[model samples]
Target: MACLLAVAAGYWVLGRGTPRPTGTWAMGALLGSFAVAFASYAPLVADGLEAIVPHVARLLSNCASLAAATSVLAISFQLNLDPVEARRRIRLRLALFAASAIGMTLLFAYEYMTHRSEQVFALYLLLFVSYLGFAVVDFLLQAVRQSRTTRRSSVRLGLRMAALGCVFALVYVAYKLTHVVSAGLNLHLVPEHSQCTSLVAVPCVFSVTCPALAVLLICLGLTLPAVVYPLSQARRRRWEVASFDALGPLWRDLSNAVPEIVLSPVDSDRGSSADADFMLQRRVIEISDGILALTPYRCRTVQRTAQSLTAADTEEAAAAVEATVVKAALAASKAGQFADEVAPPSAEAASRKDLRGETEWLLLVAAAYARVGDTGQLETVGA
Candidate 1:
C-alpha cells in the first residue's frame, strides 16, 4: 500500500504537462512523504544497528509531520489564491514548519540524553501531536469544502474519499493526544493490561486501524481522477472501431463502383493508430459521396421496382430497398447504360443532419447490403 501511494504520487507529480493552481504537486508530496514516514516507523535495528535505525525513525516521524503540515498549507492556499499569493503563503508555511521542526528535534535529543525523562518525552509528544492534528483537521476541512463544489464527477468523488480518510487520521491524532495527556498528567484513563489484551483497547485498536484505513482510502482517491479519463477514452475507441469495421463490406462495394468518390484513400492498416472518430466520419462521408456519384446511372424504374420488392415499413426493410437500388445502379453504370438525369433523393435521406443518426442509418444499410447476395434479381426488373 505504501508503495502504491508512492507510485501514485510520482504519476501525478511527474506525468502532468504544466503546473496548475490545483495543489497537485503538494498532494503528491504529501502522499510520498506520508508513505515513507509511515513505513519508517517500525524500528529495524539489530543489536549493533540500534544506534542508527531508532534515531532515523524518530527523526522521520517529526520531519514527516512537519512536511505534512506544510503540504496542507500549500494545498489550501494554492486552490484559493493566485500563484503569487499562494507562493507567498507556502513560503511562510515552510519557514514556520522549519522552525518548529528544529525545536522538536532539539527537544527529542535532550529528552533522549536525559535517560528518556518522562517530562521531556511528554513535551515532545505534545508538540508533535499538536502540529499533526492541526494539519489533518485543515486538510479534512479543505477536502470537504472542495468535494462539494468540484464539478468533475471523478474529482468530486476523489475529494470525498480523501476527506473520509482525513477523518480516520483525526481519530489517530486524538488517540496520540490521549496517550500524551495520560502519560504527562498521570491521568489513568487508559487501563493497564497485557500487551496482547491491550491491542483490543480502544486507543490501541484505533492506533492500528485508523492509519491503515486512511492510507488505503487516500491512495485510492488520489489515483482515481488520473485513471478514469484514459479508461473512458479506451472504451469509446473500442466502440468506434467496431462500428467502423461493421461498415466495411458496404464501403468496399460502393468505393469499388465509384472510386472517384474517395477523397482520402484508406488502407487495411487504417485502424492501427489513427483517430477512430475521424476515420469513421470520413468513411460515412465517402459512402454518401459514392451514392451521389452513382445517381447518373440510377434508373427510376429500378428504384420503383426495388421498393415494390421490399415495401415493408420497418428499418431493415427500408435499408433492403435502398441496398437493392444501389446494387442495380452500380450494375447499370458498369454496363454503360446511363439513365436520364433525375436528382437523386436517396443520398439526402441516407445522410442525416447529425453524425450519430447518419451512422446508425448507414449501419443498417451496410447490414442489408451484406445480406443481399447479388443485384441479378433486381436488375431484371429495371431492364
Candidate 2:
C-alpha cells in the first residue's frame, strides 16, 4: 500500500518539477522496485498463477533492482559533473543491467537453472544486492552532507528521512549477504533456531520479513516530501477560501451602506475580479472607509448601553465594545443625524499589527451593524 502511494506521489512530483531535484524520480524508482517485486511475488500475483513460470518474475525483479540502484545513485549525488560523463556513466550502467538480465533470462529459460539455490542464482543475488546496497550507503553519506548545506527546512527534513531509510536498507543488505553466504558456502552463521526444516533452514525470519521492513521505511521516506508538502499547501489554500467566505456578508453590507467608500469602484459592465488575498485586503479597506465616513453619527444611547455592559480589554471583549459602537453609529446614520458631516466623533485612527486581529474586530462590528435595524439597540454582547 505504501509503495503504491509513494509511486503516485513521486510521479506527481516528477510531473510538476517539484523538489527541484532528480531525487523525486529516484524516490519513485525506490517505490517502483518494491511494487515490481510485489507484483512478481507468487502470493501477490493473480491467484499465484506465476508460480508456474517463477523464473520470469525473477528476471523482472532483477531488472527492477538494477533500475532502482541507478536511480538511487542519480538522486544521492548532486548533478555537478560533466554532462557527457554523466550520460556515458548512465548508459554504461543501464547496458550492464540489461546484459545481466538477458543472460539470466536465457539461462533460466533453457534448463541450466532449476531453482533459486543454484550458484549462478546466488551470484546474481549478491550482485543485485551489492549494487543496491552500495547505492544506499553512498546515498546516506551524500544526503547527510547535503543536509548540512541545505537551508530549507522541508528539504533538510526530506534528506534526513531519506538517510534514516538508507539505514534500514543497509540492515537488509547485511541480512541478504548473510543468507547468500549460508546458501553458497554451506555455512550457517545462525543456529537452526533449535531445529530446522527436516532438510534445511536458517533463521526463518530474516529471509522475507527483514527486507519487507526495509522497503516500507524507504517508501515512507519517499512519501514525506511528495505527499505531505502538497497536502499542507492545499490546506492553506482552503483556509484562505474559508476566510474569504466568512467576510463576504460584511463586505456586501458595508458596500451597500457606503458604496462610495470602496477603494476600487466597480463598473456596471465589468466587475472587478481579484484573488483571495487581494479581496480580503480590499474588503478590510472598504469596511474601514465606511466606518470613517460614519464617524460623526455615533449614537450616544448605544455608547451608554455598551459601557454599562463591561470594561474588559481582551481582544474579544474589545470587539464586543466596538461592535456596539458600530451598531449604534449605523442606526444614527440611517436616522439622518450627523450622517453627512465632515468631522468625526474622535480624532484617533484605530490600528493593529495583526491582520487577523483587525479582521476579527471588524467582523464583530459588521455583525452587530447588520442587527441594529431590527433590534433598535446595541446588543449587550458581553453583558
Candidate 3:
C-alpha cells in the first residue's frame, strides 16, 4: 500500500503538464486501482471487513482494469497523427476490449457461482491469460508498425511503456496459472496436508505470494507515465531549441539592417525594395520562429502577438509588425513586454499575410541573440 501510494503520487507530479483529459483519466484509474487493492487487503487488517471487502475489492479491481484499459485506448487515439484514422483504430480496439472484458467477467462469475471448485478457478486464470495475451500481441504489432513510420518520440515511448505493462500482465497471469494448476492436482505440495506430488511447494506459498504479485503488477502499470512523460517533455524542448538555433544568423543581420533602412531614406532605399521585402520576410520568419522557440514561459505573449499579426491588414500591418518585434526583442532581452504593453500588431502589413510563419523563424533567432547580448552584430550590419 505504501509503495502503491508513492507510485500514484509520482504519477500525479509527472503528469502535471499532460493534457487535462489524459491526466484526469489516468489519475482516476490509478486511484481506482489503489481502492481495489486496499479493499482486497482490508481483511488482513481487520477480520470483520473480509467477507464484504474481498468481494467488493474483486469487483472494483475488474472495473478499474477495464477503465484503465479504456483510458489507454483514448490516449492512443489522442496521440494519433490523423484524427479520422486514429478514431477508427481506437473504436475498433475499444470494442474488442469491451467484448473481451465482458466475456471474461461472465465466465468468472458463472464459474464462481456454479462449481466453486479449483477447476473453476483454473479456468478463470486461463481466461485472464488468454485475454491479456491477445491484448499484448495486438499492441506489440501496432507498436512495431508505428515505429517504422513515425519519428515521434512520444509515440515510441508510449508504445514501449504499453509493451512493458503487457509483460507485467503476462507475469501475473503466469503466476495465477501456476497456483491454480498446483491446487487442482490434489498434490498437497503446500505442506499443511503433506500429500505427495511432483512439485514440492511450501505451506501458504500461494496464499502469501500471489496477492503480492498482483499488487506488484498494479503498481508497475500505475507508474509508467512517470517514466515516459519526462522524456517526452525533454524531447519537445530540445526540438524547439534546435529549430530556433537554425535561424540565428539571419535574424541578427535583419535586425541590424532594419534601423538603417527605415531611418536613412536614401535613393538606394528605393532600389532596396527587394532587400526590404527580404527583411520583411525575415521579420515574419523571426516571429514565427520565436513563437516556436520560446518555452511556456512566454506562450501567452507569443499567442497574443500571433493573433494580432494574423488579423491586421497591410497599412495597419507595419505598426503591428514593429510592435511584435519590439515585444519579442524585449522578451529576448529578459525585459518582459507586460511592463510596456503596446497596441496589438496589425495583420495588414506587407508581411502580415504569412506573418505567423515568418515570425516563428525570426523569434528563434532573436531569442538566441537576446540571450547572448549579440546586438552588436546588428550595428555592424547597419555600418
Q: Clashes in each model (backbone N, CA, C under 3 Å)? A: 0, 0, 30
Error of 1 at 54 (Å): 6.9
Q: For each candidate, what TM-score against the reference?
A: 0.63, 0.56, 0.45
Model 2 lDDT per residue over 80-162, tens place: 34656666766665676666666656655653345555466557667667666766776688778877887656667877877
Model 2 lDDT at residue 200: 25
Per-residue C-alpha lDDT of model 3 across residues 1-383, encoded as one tens digit per residue: 64555466455646555565444554555455544545444545334543643343454454445444554444555554477876786677668667766766776677657755666655655655565455545555565566567665545555555555555555555655565566667554333333323222443334334434444543444345556777766664554444444444544444443333232233432223324444444444544444333332233344354445444343223333433444454454453323243333334333435544444534433443443333222211111
What is residue 350's positional error in candidate 3, in angstroms? 27
lDDT leader: 1
lDDT accuracy of residue 41 in candidate 2? 46
Candidate 3's TM-score reads: 0.45
Worst 10 residues of 3 by lDDT: 374-383
Error of 1 at 105 (Å): 2.1
TM-score, candidate 2, is 0.56
Return the top candidate by TM-score. 1
Descending-lDDT candidate ranking? 1, 2, 3
RMSD of each: 6.9, 7.8, 15.7
Which regions of candidate 1 fall more than 4 Å away from where they truly are?
1-28, 45-59, 66-86, 113-123, 145-154, 191-201, 227-233, 250-263, 284-383
